[model samples]
Target: MDKLRSLTLFLATCEEQSFAAAARVCNTDPSTISKAVSRLEAELGVTLFQRSTRQLKITAAGRHYAQTVRSSILALSSCEDELRQLNDAPRGRLRVNSAVCYGHLYLRPLLKAFCQRYPEITLELSLDDMHVDIIEQDIDVALRTGFVKDSRLVARCLSPMDFVVCASPDYLKQHDMPVSLDDFNGHSWIGFKIKETQQLQPIFLPDADGVYQLCELHRTHITDDGEAMAQLCADGFGFAQLPHFLAKAGLKSGALVSLYPAFRAPMPDSGVFAIYPKRAYLPARVRVFLDFLVTALEAQQETPTHTWAQHWPPHVQFD
Candidate 1:
């Protein structure tokens, strides 16, 4: 008698509480399920179930044993999946989820190149600023920042989400440019009301020495969207602490000016991470894309934009 097979049959019987039901679930005869459960009981030297013609009942020990058996079976299944994935090619639809600003600033630029490189893989990208359940939504990958508390997902750090306090050149010219930490208290701020929490997020800034100061910013204008807040700041609303990815283009274009660039420090729990659902067998397409992103992001950090064009495939073009 196969011990694993017998254990599986026993667990199925415990769940359904009927040999016939377990048989239907396992696609086997009722007698086979019954014999397997009986064999399992004999091997364990325990009567796992109290059986009768009318109904079957699980013992107290059986209930406790089922819990352990279920976990072991799941681990075995995951191992089997991993083994199968080892031989599988990287062709398939790779579903990705990301925030809007990150998608536009970071991911959107890379898609054409990624598609060209992996012609067999089809990319299905979904953008939403709000957090969605990755497993429930069937998203293969998610580009996200900040702390990840989900135990069911694997988060690989790509970059630090460096927060840059900046505003429009016109706004800074109208008001005093924040030269010191004490100067921020005198300034009005464009506040971001978080959609998830519905509260105005406190501004956290760091100085040259890497010490952080928290500010309960005086909100002159409020919006739930990060992009909207950035646009408002660029339109000369007030000072806003924006993520570097969102502010980089504006800074380069002279639409926004970085306030105290020398004072920038790493924000706590702030990271750009490629998050994916935890699985033993990560699809090859998803794995390669993640590797590509890590390499691309590293190059983007090290090389200047004009120089980055040289790294691209000759047939691919970027502006």
Candidate 2:
């Protein structure tokens, strides 16, 4: 029996706690895995697991041994990765998770270009609107809007994403463009849910006796989905506070009119973000992608109104 295979088999068995699972990881049969573990136990003169009819439990010695062996395996893998990158070509399948609209509008093209440039690299993309635990999902990178307050990950700022308070031109013509924050209470509101803050921040600006103020409440329409909210507002249902990136075309084409023009509202956070696990020695692929995005975003800021072009792709980027 190969000693490395036996050691890895023992490690996998310790992690998965089942002969079938360990065998699957090792690309062999459960009997092969069991035989390897038995050989390991024989060589070490110690049983690592105390197995029962219904369950498998690690022995006290096994617990300590597993930690040591796991660390060794990780170190070896890291070394292999370093060697791979040092060869001047980083190659692997990187998993990326992001929200729906941003993935479509922004990340899609950038990712496409990246993959085209590096044919050796592949991407597994997950587009979702809900927040998830990055560690639990085994995600290599995540792109999210606004703030991520969890102390576990590192949040990098990409660009200043502002809001556009808008409603379709027809809707505004029919409904009163209430002149004050208090006036917004009576008007229909389209609420956008902020995952980071866990808050529904709508676009409601009002003048409190000649003084400008922000109205973040009195939501008549609330949805966790942004695309649906935008459609409803575009169809003349109500006012929707949308990201500048998402609302530009509608505003420019006269389909939607920007509301509260005089008083501008702070974005609360950046729309473009590059998030990753907070640890030293970042992966080459992740670093390259992050740098590429930051550069692309800066190029976009110099020409601010490009997002309003009808021909412009949903995610505004240089083609």
Candidate 3:
């Protein structure tokens, strides 16, 4: 009789409390279960059960041994599961979540290529402007902008977020271009409202010393959506501070003009991140998706489509 097989049979007998019941559960004869338990008892130098014709009763020592063996079996099973996951091919449903604007501008374009590369992975993407609980939502991975403070998650910085103060060409033509921070006094402002907090996002302006300071500007137009806010600004509403990802197209197409490109907010939450729940073993699907996204983003940086850093002064360095 194999030792592991004997242990398994012994545990089954302990759980069932009857050789016949254990035999039925293990798909063997009652005699086999009895022999395995008897051998286990002899090896341990203790009588594990008080067997009578009517019922089988476990001793205190048997109960304690069962508890120990159960935990060891569970630990062994967990190790085997982790090893299997590590070696398994990437094939499963991968649930991904992303912020709305970033998903539209960046992630959406790369989906087809990712799917073509990993045909085995079924991709399910959810785009929301509001933050979500990845663990509760059963999300495998998430793309988020700004600083991630959740202790339960692991965040990798995909790119640095840059905000550009911009206005439509018509608006800049009508109003004096803000050459200095003092010139912002009478200018109309278009602000972005955070739907979650129901508060307007703060505007950070650089002082004469180039230090960013939060300033309150009267908002002439406000919207929770980044695209809508950019549209309102482009339609000659007011000066707005927009994320580079949102402002890039407008600036390139000559719809919007970058105002005070030298001054930028040193926001604490200033990076686009790839976020996921921390685990001992990462699934192959998730690992491949992250790798694909990183590679794609790196390729985009090599082209003019995502040249966000080019808008900044040459002296500034980003990681």
Q: Candidates' lDDT values, in order?
A: 0.75, 0.69, 0.79
Q: Residue 29 lDDT in model 2?
A: 96
Cα distance off (Å), candidate 2, residue 170: 1.3
> For candidate 2, lDDT tens digit of each residue in 278-301?
654566777777777777766665
How many clashes in each candidate? Answer: 0, 2, 0
- Lowest lDDT sum, 10 consecutive residues, model 2, at 310-319
lDDT of 1 by residue, 267-286 (tens): 56556778887777676888
Winner on TM-score (1 vs 3): 3
Query: What clash pairs does model 3 have?
Result: none
Model 1 clash pairs?
none
Task: Quote the lDDT for 243 in model 1.
Answer: 68
Error of 3 at 255 (Å): 1.5
- How much is the lDDT of residue 294 in candidate 3? 87
Q: Each prediction's TM-score against the native?
A: 0.66, 0.68, 0.68
User: Among all windows of ten consecutive residues in candidate 1, which has the lowest summed lDDT?
Assistant: 309-318
CA lDDT, candidate 3, residue 209:
68
> Candidate 3's C-alpha lDDT?
0.79
lDDT of 2 at 297: 67
